[model samples]
Target: MNSMTRIPLTQLDAREPKSSGPQQARLPSAADVPRARDTQFKDTHGRRFSYLRLSITDVCNFRCNYCLPDGYQCSDKTEPLTLEEIRQLAKTFAAHGTRKIRITGGEPVLRQDLPEIIATLKQTPGIETVALTTNGYKINQHIDNWKAAGLDQLNVSIDSLDPQVFQTITGHNRLHEILTGLDRALELGLSRVKVNAVLLKGHNGDQLNRFLDWVKTTPITLRFIELMETGQNPDYFAKNHLSGESIKQQLLANGWQQKIRSKDAGPAQEFDHPDYQGSIGLIMPYSNDFCSSCNRLRISALGKLHLCLFGEQGYDLRHLMKENKQTELESAIRHLLQDKKASHFLHDGNTGAIQHFAQIGG
Candidate 1:
């Protein structure tokens, strides 16, 4: 482990040590501020935001080409929010009607206390789902404990089915471990285990048939994500970027049929194979703009609330937490929610802050 990624034991203890009851003082009521008429996290545009993606740490073991640049440096300058802090933060959001929470990271499982963290979030009154998005490297060791800790769903990133191709893309040769972990998760009766594959034009593009073949053997959903501009090498993105449309056409050509449009909370467009037990999801951030139905708010590891993934600015919740003012925290969150950007500028020709996906928590 890198020195910068290590959390101080004292600070961890201050996070209200696990055995103790809820460490955070009860949130002060926001009675003075009139509750917004519709949904809690909704903005003026009528978009009801319920999903919150919280990144537990910015340190990643693998330097995936699509998410981080080569020779990327992890900053040890700042301490990430402690688990107790995340608990209080989730409480604030749940109080405001955010029901679904996805715990993310450079790799969430890298955090030793992640199972306990999931248990903490699950204990939150209004939090209905406590899901996770991981690289699947270390999940096998903790799968059973995590499920026992109240983890509801999982989204594991498997860049390629071929070991050599996966090694080239992720700069890691642990494809077998990831696959084994996924198998264990499914066998454990995990209700939803979505395999996320980032589609690189000429790289793993040839393996779609194999992926579909594997899907026929399982009930887990497979999601293909389009490579987007995430501040990595522009040359790399331009060369590897595969549009969801092309992939969709390929799927249709292979006999996969579109499923009826149902009300889904997230952005993936769904398609299914009649003979298979599972379905396929295409996340075309580059080809299709799903911001009109965006219902997510992301909190980076250091405690900044990012309203839009590509938005340039974020409100600092860590500072408010330090101040220990619940009313002010809730007020600031609402103001920031109301000021959420109407659309993401990630599409071609428009660019905001060029951020690495690690910093923003993918």
Candidate 2:
């Protein structure tokens, strides 16, 4: 989208190693580097947690067909957590081994005080990254201010490049606004601007080539995510379930090669096209086994800790925070982390206890 030179993927090494070559092991010279000994969050399965997805709010502007059915209404019975509460939770999380945090919402940009919130998260010690996931409607308006507030990365949800199709899926005619946000973000030096698209059959599923064409025109990575069986949209999931493997197969047939996997990429399995500098990523939560190495926890807008995305139950941290039980809250947090389940039950085609993505700040 920006008028910058695009590097052909063929020109870059597809199997390029992270390092030039294996060097002699050296001892740490700086005390700033975190040691494994100091790592705090680990489960009985020995999976160490380092990532936190903090949902700031449960209100979203778009009524995506899959995320929220038409005419769906969110309850206003519970007040959303305040900024001071978020600051305290972030500090507690950082002190207990959280390295990266992603601030999410129904649409995080809806929060007018987002810039201040980003600044607060950035100021927390031991938190190396503070990112946001938004629909990109309001991001363009505050991108500059957010960047100034120490925002590091962004994940924008754009399912289709076609305006009509995008509108049909998201129930909004704001594709241009998202594109503008993407362009502004690229121009603003956000090195990792990821375009996240949930793959749904017969709904933007035919736009793979268009997506590829657009990716080649920009410097952002395109991530194709498999539609999970969020309970709220069981009928949609049952009717339009497209596996990430099929997407990868389609890309492979188009001359894309599976990227090397020496480094951990969390959920997505990345692939590189020989002709395009930008790569494609596939997140197969249901079709592929991805929970073995999972190292993240999610916090809802209500301050509940969810060890698994499909977790039917969650521990309420808000009650502790409201009761001013700081020490008990810390202990409860640790206990929840330690007792986290080994994996989610989505593999069994069950949506579990949660179905509303908006409720979890999805």
Count of steric clashes across candidates, in order: 0, 1
Model 2 over residues 1-362: C-alpha lDDT tens digits? 00112222222221221222222222122232323565477778977778899988878888898887663476554666688888888887888788899999777888888999999999999999999998888777889999999999999999988999899989999999879988899999985899999998979878888999887868788999888887678788889988888888888888999887644348778888767868899989875468876878888877777777776344456755543655555666665554466677776666655667776765
Candidate 1 lDDT by residue in tens digits, 210-255: 9888999889999999887754557778898888898899889988
Cα misplacement distance, residue 74 of candidate 1 (Å): 2.4
Model 2 alpha-carbon miss at residue 233, Å: 1.4
Off by over 4 Å in 2: 1-38, 262-264, 322-326
Point out the worst 10-residue segment of candidate 2 by lDDT: 1-10
RMSD of each: 8.0, 13.4
Q: Each model's TM-score, in the order given?
A: 0.87, 0.86
In order, the Cα lDDT scores of the candidates are 0.76, 0.76
